[model samples]
Structures are given as C-alpha cells and as structure tokens.
Target: MSEFLNVNEIKEKVSLLNLLNKLGFAAQKVSGSEHFFLSMLREEYTASLCVNDKLGVWYDHGAAGVSGIKSGSIIDFGLAYWYPASFPEVLKKIVEYAGVPLEKSHDIPAVYAERKTALKSSTYQINSISETITNPAINAYLNMRGIGSVAAGHLYELHYSILDSKNKSRNYFASGWPNENGGWEVRNKYFKGCLGHKGMSFLQGAANRLAVFEGFYDFMSWKVENPKDPASTLILNSLSFLQSAKARAKQFASIEIYFDHDRAGMLGSEEFAADVAGSVDCAFKYEGFKDYNEKLTAGLSASKKSLDKPMIFSAENGFGR
Candidate 1:
C-alpha cells in the first residue's frame, strides 16, 4: 500500500464530517461536531450515519451495528460508502480529498488544547486598522473579488507576523474584519485565517430583520448590491458560530441567510433555518455560484455553468502537515 494509505495518519488528520461534506453528503442535522446524515449507501426515511468531527470518526449504526462493527475511522466509513470500490481506490480518493497525512502530534484533544494555547500566545499583533486601501496587493485583491472601494472601506488593513510550524517568523499584511471577540479574520490572495477570538460580527441597524452571511466578503458583496437595504447584518466568520447566531436571532423578527452553496453551507443553512423561525434561505439568488463573492466575480454568464466540484484546499500538497 502507498504511504498515503497509512490508516493511522489519515485517521488523525482528516475530519470525517468535512470528508462527507466534500463528498456531497449533506448532514441532515448537526449538533456540535456530531453530524447526522442520511446514509449514502442505503435509502432510509431517517438518518443513520453520524460523523464526529472532533474525533475524525463516524458510525453507521444501522449497517455497521448489524455486523457488530458499531463504529470505525473515516477509512472504514469510506469503504462502506463507496461499495465496490477497492480499498486502495477509496484510500487514494480520501488521501486526495484530505491532503497529505499530518505529522504525528499529541492526541486530538491535546492538540486541540495546544492550538487554543497557540492562538492565545500568538506572536502576531494587529498594529492598526485603516480605512484606506493603499496596499496595491489588497486593493487588487478586492478588485479581483469585485468589491469596490466604498465596500472595501468596511474592511481594515491588518499587519501581523506568524511563526510557521518550523518556528520561522514571517510577516503579513492583509485585509481584516473585526469579530465580536476583538479578533481579526485576516485574508489576502495567498492566506486566510483568524488572528483573535473566532466569533460573529454584526452591524447594528434599525431593521427588525437581520441578514446573515457566512463571511465578511459575502457581506461586502451584498452591500455592493443593496447599499440601501437597512436589514441588520450578521456575519458568522465561521460556521461554528451558527448556534450563537441562532440564539441571537430571537432578538429580531426574521432572518435572511446567505450561505455558500456547498454541501456544508447548504446543510448548515437547513440547520440554521430549523433553529430560527421565519429564517429564509436567500442562496437561490446566487444560483450556481458557490458564494456571494463568487457570484460577484463570475458574473451572470458564469452562473450558467455548474459549480459542483470537489472541495479543494490549499493544504492539498504538503501544507496539511
């Protein structure tokens, strides 16, 4: 077997829920990291597949339990889902989707704790936030995304430096959006990450209805299109804040969600709608585009084409480690 098929390596790094999402399996419901999905291998009125995102494992109670195999790693789940596909083929496909196996570190929980610690001890610091769009790279980035200067003003220029896994310091200058926890979600042509606490950012307005977006760029795109729309805006910098958004929704009369059209996004929209009464999925406006930014950049002509492609990550080569 190839090194990519290393069972322990794949089990440690790849998120089963993310894998299922990338494979076009939308969860019927998500609670915390546990995603309940209708089994892809069999037809059923109810969901029997559950994936634990935190553990990178899954359980198909209906099928696996019949054989006294109650649970398994992502590899096992993939083998069952892909049916006649040989073990090698399924493993290869998983490796491609998940990127190279991550280097062995501490256990999942320990590593998670360390990541939180690293975030708290970040060497990066936000020097300032300017309304000006002076950086050519940032300005070009916005232009490429079809975000105008006026809309760009909503984002700030961030200055920070981070040490990579090798402990080498590197500086960065990117567009930043401030979240509620006073952290910055930094983005540029080459990088995407957060600098502080990860949470939602809201723009206070007089409207009783709130417009929820998956990212600040999407919110900016919506602003470019509906500058006068007075609906209060909420941008979940990440989907983990969806529950928090649901709780916040009680304060408003209704909410209009504009999430991406990907499997995760579509499934999250469903869960969000189920949690918040009078919530409307507004993603239909984008139609075939992946997200609002994509719709903006691709234009009407591109919308005619399909965006149903596998989820590709920057870490696909060797960055996953």
Candidate 2:
C-alpha cells in the first residue's frame, strides 16, 4: 500500500459503531437510531457519549467543559479517542478496526461490503456561502473564543448539507475560511472538518517576516492581541502541513511559530526551528495554556472578573489601586 491514505474513502467505508464494538465498548442504552454509551475517553457513571448511527457522528455531552473536541465525525472521534496519535496512525487503526483492507482488493469481506453500501451516500455539500457571518450559533462560538470582532473579514458563513444513508439531507451552517487550495476550513460548535482538499491558509503581509500558527483560531487570537502586526501569516490548519509551511517560511528572514503547548506542538516547534534558520518558537507566550486562543479567552475571562469586582474606598493599598 502507498504511504498516502485517502481519508474520505476510509470514512465512507468504515462503520463507527462496529469499530466501537470491536473495541469492547457496547452501548449502555439505545434510543431510536442513537446509541448512548459511557465515554471511551473518560470514566463516568452515566452514559454521556452519544453515537448517532444514522449520521455517523458522535457527541460527548460531558466533554463541553473539557479540552479537545465535544462532537464530530468518526475521524474526529478516532483522533480524540487515540489522543497524541498521528493522523496516519489513526487512519490505520480505523481501517483495522473496521476490517477494511488498506489496499484496494476485489475479494472484499462481506461485512466491509455492507458498511460501504450503507455509507456510500453520506456526503457533505455546500449549499451557499455568505460574505458576512450572521448565524447566532456561529457568532456565539466566535465570541466565546474571543475572536468575534476580528473574525469579520477572515471568515464566512457557510450553509451546507449532509446527505445521509437514506438520501435525506440535513441542513447546517458554520463559519468557514478558504484555504490555499480553494477548499474551506470549516468549524462550528459541534463540527470541525475541511469541505474540500485540505491545505494551509496564507495571508499576505511583510516579505521579510512570517508568523506560523497551527490553526486559524490561533491566528485570529494573535490578531486580536496584535492588531498592528505586519508579519506575513501562515495558518497550517493542521500540523500535517508543517513540512509545506516550513518550506514557505524559508523565503522570509524571520519566522515566529505559535503552535500548541502540548507534546506534539513542542516537537513541531522544535523541528521547525531546527530546519529553518532564524526561526523562533513563540509558544512561550501562552506557555501554560494549550494554544493562543485558550490564552486569549483566559485573559478575557480575567478582565471580565476584574470589572465585576466591587470597589472599596479604604486607604489600604490606595483603594486597591
């Protein structure tokens, strides 16, 4: 098999529920087409993770306040379930669990054939794109991330549909931005995925300096803090595009990297700094937080708390300054 993996093909061919079963996780309860199970991610007395068998999606009700994703497609679940695993590794595991062959084969298994037939019609179609974002949910999500004010020119309101196995289309909306390959990097509260070919987003600025970020939210967070920055920016959208981003950074005299503060982010930052001379890892600015956006949101929360505090007119410490 080639090193390249067709992610969409695997998603279409694999059965998420079947994979869960293979992993020794059975649904604690079943409600119509939805199956409820204890979160594979964390221990819980009640089942909070729900797998919608009909739509091939999962959502963990208890994960909203936790780090990582709360809801997404099967691929997203795989990545979250197998935390710290590379994308290729996750894909291989999914294929293995689903009993699907990595390479194309004429002698397909019966179970694999049934899954393919059931999911063949599952697809995401873009219905329309609006230059301005107006959806309340999208706006709330952006504001929650402390980027609503800066997201105006950088994002769009995307109206799309997901075609299910029964040939019924479910309409949804999200905030999206275009990538270099003319595809969209879309995100809402519950979903995050590319609408087409995944690639990095490059924003033109200074020719001598560049700032690289792992995702668009981090880029926007930096913009929120530094509105006057003149450096050219590259949002990798995914760490898998680090090699391409590094090659692009070589043209600039200086590069600033703001990856997450996790193990993978630290390794990526170190690798980029090693390959490209004059490159610096700027993740130290958000050292304790996961990423730039997390730091930004924390700052916003702190400011809100300060504003809400009651003032005392005592002489102690000059009336609390």
Candidate 3:
C-alpha cells in the first residue's frame, strides 16, 4: 500500500524545473537560475511563471496575481495543477510521479509555508517623492515631450533604482505614478522600471463613466487636454494590466480606452470592448500616431521648429510679397 507523504518531502526531493521539463513545460525564458514559462494552465503571449532553481521555489504570476498564488513549493504547484483535489489525492499523485514512497508525515516544506506578500507591491525602494519637478533632467524630458506643467504637477518626482540579474545596481530619478500595489512606475529619459508591486493605477473621480489609458503619460496628457472634465481614470502601466483594468471597468457605466496604435493595443482594445459592453476605443482620434502623447509632442515640436525658422523673404519665398 502507498503510504502518505508530507508536502516537505515532495518539495525537498522533487525538482520542479526538471519535473516541468519532463512534463513538457520547457522554459520560455531563463535568467540566471530562474526560468520563466508561458503558464501551462492558460493561453498567454508572455511568460509569467518563474521557477527559481536556486531557491527551489516557483512563482506563477498568471492572472496578475488575481489567482491568489504567486510563489510556492512543488506540492503547492501540484495542488494548483490538480485544483480542487483533496490533499490526500494531491499527495498520492505526487508520490506516484516522483517515485517516492508514501511514507506518512505531517510536515510541510518551509518554502511552501512562507507567508505570501501582497502581490501588488514591487521589489523597488522609493527613496523619496516630491510634488515639485525639481530634477532638471526630468523636467527637460517631460517638457520636451510636451507634457504640460499641469500634468507634471500631479506626478511625483521619484528617486528609485532596480537591480539586474547579476545583482548589479542601476539607480534612477524619474517621475513616478503609484500603482494599486503601492509600487512606483518610474520613468525617465534613460530608464524605465517599476519599484514595488505592479498593477494598474486607478484615480477615482465622478463615477458612471471612466477613461482608461495604456500609460501614465497618456493619462496625464489627457488631463492636460481636459482638465475641467476630469473623470475617473485607470492607468494600465502595461498591457499586462489589461485583466485588472477589465475587472475595474465593471464599476463604471462606460469605459473609454486610449491605447497605442499598435497590434497589441488593437488586440487589447478588442478584448476590452468584448468584456465591457459600453467601452469605447478613442484611438481613432489619434490615428496615424503611436499614441496621444506622440501626437501632442509632435505637434509641439513642429510648432517650435516653425517658430525657430528665420524670417527670410525672397521672390521664390512669397510671404505677402
């Protein structure tokens, strides 16, 4: 008779990466000892599940953490695989797979026992935040991009940094927007990354109808364009936030999506429209441009160039000649 085996026994003995490989989940991407895969349970374009071979842990970022599971041990993964299965059944299946005897035990692995962190928070530290845009580089960057002072005023000047795979340090000082996970989506001319958790940034105003933007810059540009008619807004820092945005869109009577004029944006808009009955895609207004900000910046740059041109009057160049 196959005896029962503890969760720890499975985790300590079973190699998750190897098991995944054997099970035909070849890693889609690898960084150092961590392997990323495009999730076995769902259809997605990007790899979300991360298996850390060094720490002997796996993190499934599928569903933007809405699944309520991120990092876990092999047994926990088994439970996700055989969802709604009894613990005894899960244990038995693992035992049969790993060729481990079902020795009765109550001990679960420490890795699986670790407390789950709030999925929304990210891994970056926010050293400082200010209402004023004091950094000259940031100011120039924003102004050059045609993001007005009104939009800049609402943004926080953030001091933050992110570490690479080798644990190397790269710091940045940029304008930041706070996401639902309390992470700062930091951006400057030179760098772009998140500090803390990653999710959508929702700003509540008048209800019923809401405006959605793919990036904070577009949201701010929208604000600059329509300061008086401020309504509820959702800033999806990335298309990855599309699901979370969809969930949030339910509370509003209608939604206006302002995504880029790209293939991903078109697909995302279609999905959003399908999910929300009254959702409107406002991208057509800025057609032929990548985004609203691009149009705004291009218009501003063209005006500046026109003004910079010297007044040269000749027979060929007729200006009321």
Candidate 4:
C-alpha cells in the first residue's frame, strides 16, 4: 500500500482539525460525511467530532447551509476567514491541524540563553512540521520589536527539524516559554506564550487579588502598567486556556481577567466570570482594546480595581509594556 501523507502534510492541504483547534471549536458528528466547525453553542468538545474511522465522513452539528469536507478542506475555509492573506506557513498549520504525519520537527537552539536579541529569527517550525517560518509576513513579524522583544526575554525559539512544502529537510523556530510543561497560545505573528496556570506565571502575593491577561504581550504590558500594584497575575495566553486555568485559579478569592477584548476574548471572559462569579471576591474586566498590547500601544493607563464600577480596568488614557 502507498504511504499516506502525515498530519502536517494533510494540514497543508486543508484545515480540518487545525481550524477547530485554533478557534477552540468542537466537531459534531454527522451521518454521511465527516465535517466539523467550532460551535460556540456546543456543550462538550470531543463529543462534537464525529470521527468514523470506518467511514471518513465528517459533519459539523452547529454549522448550517453547505456541508461535508475532509479535514484539509475544512482548513481551506478556516484560514480564508480567520487568517485572510494567509501567512506562508499557515497552510502547513492546517496540515498539522488534521493530525497527518509530518516530515520533521524543531527544538530550541543552544546559543539563545546568552543573548539579548535585537533581531528576530526568519521563521519558526515545529518538529514534524511540514513548513518553515520563512513566509515574508512571518519574516516581517519576526522583525517587529514586539515579537523580538519577547524573543530576547523569557520566550525562546525551538529550532526543530521540519519538512517544508517542497518536502526538503529544514528547521523551524517556534516560540515557546522558557519553562517546561508550558503549552502555547500565539497572539500576533512571532509572538508565542503559554496560557495555562502552569509554572510560576501565577506567582502572587498573599492578597487574594489577581490579574488576568490573554497574551504574553499584554501580560508584560500589564506589569508595565501596574508597576506598583503587587498582586498575583495569570496569563491565559489564549482564550482556550482560561477554563482549565480557572479551575486551578479558584484557590484565590479574587481573579481579575485582563484578556484580549476581541470576540474570542470577550467570550472567554464571560465564561471566566461565570466560573468564578460567586466563589471569588471579584472578577474584573479590562476595558482595554481588542488586545492588551494594542490598547497599551494606543496609549492606555494602567490601573487595578476600578472604583467607578465593578471589575472594569480601562486603559483608555494610554498604557505601555
């Protein structure tokens, strides 16, 4: 039998699991064909995906109108809508989405710990990745002081092996937190950070108060803003990490979430509020922009526990990282 392309390869061709994974969407099983969509309405996740290994038919329960696609085709729609302009390596992310086998992967380089990098690596790749971080957009993203700033700090690039679209051997640099057991949640390009309460990101004083942020940039920015507000902080990194992190964070009497203000952030914030509503002394919302970094870039003020109302931390006056 001829060998089939692996998960990374399949993601390049389409975004079945990739799309769902990125959006934190769950797949719903259908009768004939296999297809899935991120359903905000779905109650449970794994249950949503209908993977009939026997018959490759996937269907999404929450989606309406048109129907049916293999994981790859699903990615086609996901990227087209979510990441228009489709960064060069995005298609490969799609392949990784489908769980297909990829040619290679990458790991961190040894030369990093001694440097305060002013420049960014050209691209980042994953071990078993089917693409490289060489996309012009990715290159430019690497150049951004924002992405590079993190690079020079706690985050490092994993210079793992990979197979580019040409199927040639190559290495990719994926951004990862310095600590072990930390998973990832990327914001703007080249900016990778972890969201879980894993590691010491939640180190806080004895006060029950806590600060929550959605991405690394914003988390860094919050510290820049609240230089004097000595409290515990948690960076969900991505909206996806909030739920699990919430369960772990309940130990504190108050948890203030400074998540991104985008649709995803808002959704996660609501869930967070619901999760810790009565249990915690307070659950605050950052009235910042769609994202903390953006709001800080736009010049917002740093503050904690707004006296004007309950849990509204506004960055309207201008803040910085």
Q: TM-score of each candidate?
A: 0.58, 0.62, 0.65, 0.44
Q: Write the per-residue lDDT of candidate 3 for residues 1-321, one digit (tens) a residue.
A: 544567666677778886775443567579999998766433355778899977888887765322244567776676555433445676777777666564576664454434222211222445788988788888888898778466455688988654444555567698887877545677889766565445578888878889999888988777777888657989888775566578779888888999989877887898899988889999987888999899888889889888888876778768631
- Local distance difference test scores for all models: 0.70, 0.79, 0.71, 0.44
Give the top-scoring candidate (TM-score): 3
lDDT score at residue 40, model 4, on the 0-100 scale: 23
Cand. 4 Cα-lDDT: 0.44
User: Tens digit of lDDT per residue, candidate 4, span 204-255?
Assistant: 5657777776556666666555656867777553343454467756777777
Off by over 4 Å in 3: 1-124, 161-170, 313-321
Q: Number of clashing residue pairs in every model?
A: 0, 0, 9, 46
Cand. 1 TM to true fold? 0.58
Stretches of candidate 4 off by over 4 Å are: 1-153, 172-175, 178-207, 278-288, 300-321
Where is model 2 more than 4 Å wrong at Cα?
A: 1-120, 311-321
Under the 3 Å rule for N, CA and C atoms, how many clashes does model 1 have?
A: 0
Better of 1 and 2 by lDDT: 2
Q: What 10-residue stretch in candidate 2 is worst by lDDT? A: 112-121
